[model samples]
Target: MIPAMPKPLTSLLTLLLIAMAPAEKLRSETTTDWPSFRGPGARGVAEGSTIPTTWNADPESETNDGMLWETKVPGLGHSSPVVVGDRIFLLTAVPDEGETELNIAAGGNIDAAKDSGAYKWMVLCYDADTGKELWRQTAHHGEPKATRHSKATHANTSVCVDGDRVVACFGSEGLYCYDLDGKLIWERDLGVIDVSKYDIGWGYASSPAIHDGKVAVIGDDPDHPFVTVLQLTDGEEVWRSDRSEVCERSWGSPLIHEVDGVTQMIVNGFPWIVSYDFATGEELWRLEGGGDNPIPTPFVSHGWIYITNAHGGKAPIYVVRPDARGTIKLDSEEDSDSLVWSVERGGSYMSTPVVSGDYLYLGNSNGVVRCFHAKTGEKVFQKRLGKDAGVIASLLAVNGNVICASENGTVYVLKTGPEFEVLAENPMGEPCFATPAVADGVLFIRTTKRLVAISEPE
Candidate 1:
């Protein structure tokens, strides 16, 4: 005889058991999409994938080599590549060498910015499988309206994708959108944005974060700073909130997270780590005593937010707990009701760190890699990368391997745990300033001139 169907309440209980299983057991056993600056949601963690422990991209033959494919892109931009399905999208700023370049050495730890007399901002597409150029769309072309720091470029901000629409923001130049086939949909000229640190001319570099059919941008210009959300379908303004608590430079991109059934937009600023309500652009919560020139992206993990910045001043790493409401502040050296824990001294100068398993790994400007317990703020290990590697690109985690690339072109893979173990040090033979993107066991790394894909031998 056939067994009788389970009752409604019994079926509901069975479904709950499966839903409450460990994440590893219930994770979507599929290759996820790397659709934004630091992959999906900018969490910097790739689920269910194993990247190559060692690989090279200089091979000439197309046979199963370390280099799957390499494509040389025109112009200069530190924007990271985004991958969706079979295509990869990227942005560039072709320098018109005939014109004057705005090359300036304004400060420390950054290369002087150079300007070509005239420039062309472009949106290019490539085949993710073979690195073949699919299409190139020029978004804007003319003399730059704003200046750039020596270490920054015209196209420093990465483009973001939402289904079929791709949005690209060329600070001061304009904000443009295009369909998947390179058709221009809508454009908005937001005027010249004076994004500087202490009135120093550093180019803007914050990428837009797309969520729920809206694009959210955090512009921390010293004059008339504001955070606004726009509708993706028609470029209509949804909401704009003026920021009154910023005084220094912040090139970090904001992040969108759904916490406790409410969507919050979290941004890292000079003196405040602020969270805003996404629906109405209302200030939900704020944290004080942040870095001076914050460039690291605000990292949201589990239910906490981790941020760090250093400008020779209040260089701190703050671990924040959720359930924050209204105004909040924490002492520079003490933990409080909203702060889970904070490190008053040690933090990264640039490059957003990544969390793997139970430990958080950070790589700094001097290539010093450190590990800390994510929950209790316990120190695990601190080891210099040796050779003065000096890491500017952020770190990422792939299947328990913490991937960190240095400025001088070495990708260090470390095992994730309390004890440190050097998994592999893969050198790319070029200066890497942009972060790498991981999808389906492949690593797409952008050096100064080319975007190369690395994967296991086919």
Candidate 2:
């Protein structure tokens, strides 16, 4: 015999049910959800009709007219913000005290003003409409093992959101999963992380990509050079593939593409752009020519895979034809036949190449952006963006405009064409490393100190 519930209580229960209903329904819609590092297929291309090409072009205004909303963030990070419908997610970290010990371990000179106590891993949730912080999750409020020279606080990785579950990887700390409302689901520890190879550099920065039902993570540990795929529902290890030729870990994100009805997971790490069968985690094909430290994600177009080795000692773009069998090497002149063409000048070190129609565009860390023909790998146009601006974030194409953010928190919006056209330059006044996310007419930019929303004025 249960007692009758009050009317207000019943109404509240009904409201709660309505709120939870959307989370379940969102699983059915694919295009609106950016579930991985660079959106669907990891292509960094968003599909929607409302992306803006020109907004607030005049820089003389006292306030940003077309800006939607802006909110300040805690700490700094190079990881980009991920969007899933109305909620935007970002990862950040705050370093701990004992400046000398942590700095020494990180292989850097101690700076009293820059040192902050015990690193705190944070995941923040903001309203995509108003740029308001709805909730935050902080993990492991302690000092990290060490830091990387060019690494940021939130350099662990970007967030991947699938329906109600959002996954974020904080190396050394663990991998975390949260519900859409910011409730902790589960966290898995990957063990102690050390940067012995890159001279005790920063932790992992590869964002996870989800395909079919597994989340793919490239764990390039020296003892275990493998890609780990986990079940999306329960975070269980599905399959792990290990191969010979141990390569160093890179900051590049993995990409998923379909070629001739076969789905392949393409990962560009140091020394290789290895493709794996999405379902079984089997190494299908490998294109080896990257530098000793590959950090940019590979872009595919015109039946060719374009990859650049940032510090490969040589500045050359490796264009490989993926129509071959296992492990194609471009070491010799004969082997270079499979290679379409290699451009040795004006390549990128950090920024991933963006393919717009038939042209491939890339910005190097030295602020030089170049465009190349997609079919023949021929250089089309090149221009220097900022005099001293170094780009650590990938370029974003929205409504015919190429939006690129720099490490100094300035976003240069240029028109994509055979020639460079500077449209607008917006500054957030803080360091930024994450690529911009454009969806449903709104542009999302995450800086070290804030998350800004730029859109057409109402």
Candidate 3:
């Protein structure tokens, strides 16, 4: 008989086993649960699922080919819907005294919305298959600690799930955790997480990321920016690292990835893009220079980490190695060991690019879509989807097709390849700021006023 292993040794071995596995393999193979923003590992790819390419967005249309069901979602929110098994979870903020509207456009407007009142920060769940309301909970209710951009919403961060627990971050309001049955387990106060630009409040949009029984959060407040890790089981603080000096403000979500036997939480910022040790919150690597307004989350793909930002006259796409350390120089030549390949321009301002098959697809806010070689920084093609359609939602990959949703409510589906081929252009009628989620062969999209589930109708 073999001897029993010690608890500490067993835990260490368990971690090693997890670290050895690829980030994609960490998720269950039986069910594709889009538990966070841009899906598992933030890769934005749903394998073995058939996402609908065409659908009728009209509510009263009888010939709805791919329309499954759309349920009315109350209030305004930019938080994308998350999926866990058979339920869909999301966050919204409904004002108690006044109503606010979203300014959906691609122009250069830095004004704050003229709206403020006591809001009910709500957590809502719905049946994934039927689009029926499951339950809703008010996480917090009061006036916001800060204002939001004209194009931003009070609830801009997406919720994340870890099979058993659901977590939502309401910027300065609070962070709350709940069970699958809508039972409140715990909540944490993160103080005033004011994410601003030039002393103007743009509100916070970074979503909480969960990995291996822990949750990672990025609070890029201008005064006290930080990256913190908390226990997902009970919301206890595990570690926190300050970034007041390096980072000014950021709206992107933190990414948790394990590469080269080390797990790191990567964040995007204006002057510095930093990576921290996931377990201890220690600063591991840093890169300088990118778009001034860092709104795109960093993702790992094809054995390289991809980081992109576009604003303030500098649009760059940086592809770095997983084991990079210290401060990497911005002038490093392409194809280098540490810096990999980087381009000075052609990065998206709002949408996060997605890599599928052989090309990486990027969509800008002004309806421009570009495709580049995944391995080499070679531009394949660049085309405009529409005249003024704003593509704010990040790109999505299903099987071999890329889904691009514009601010004008049109969902463009294109076949993945070096050639530019649009498969379909379906309209959603209302504006769409939140990114869509996919799970169990269904597409769940959050428009301005509803959560619509789309699938190929039989």
Q: Pick the candidate with the highest lDDT.
A: 3
TM-score per candidate: 0.89, 0.84, 0.92
The residue-by-residue lDDT of candidate 3 on 89-125, one tens digit each, is 9999999976789877839989888886699999999
The digit string of per-residue lDDT tens for model 2 on 135-172 reads 99885677665455444443548888876888888766
Candidate 1's residue-wise lDDT over 93-197, tens digit each?
897675223222222544435564788999999988899999999999898887787767788888898888989988788888899889999998877777876
Ranked by lDDT, top first = 3, 1, 2
Q: How close is candidate 3 to the true structure, as a TM-score?
A: 0.92
Candidate 3 colliding pairs:
none
Positional deviation of residue 422's Cα in model 3 after best superposition, in angstroms: 1.1
**Where is the poorest 10-residue window by lDDT in model 1?**
98-107
* Candidate with the greatest TM-score versus the true structure: 3
The per-prediction tally of clashing pairs is: 11, 7, 0
Q: What is the lDDT of residue 207 in candidate 3?
A: 94
Error of 3 at 94 (Å): 0.3
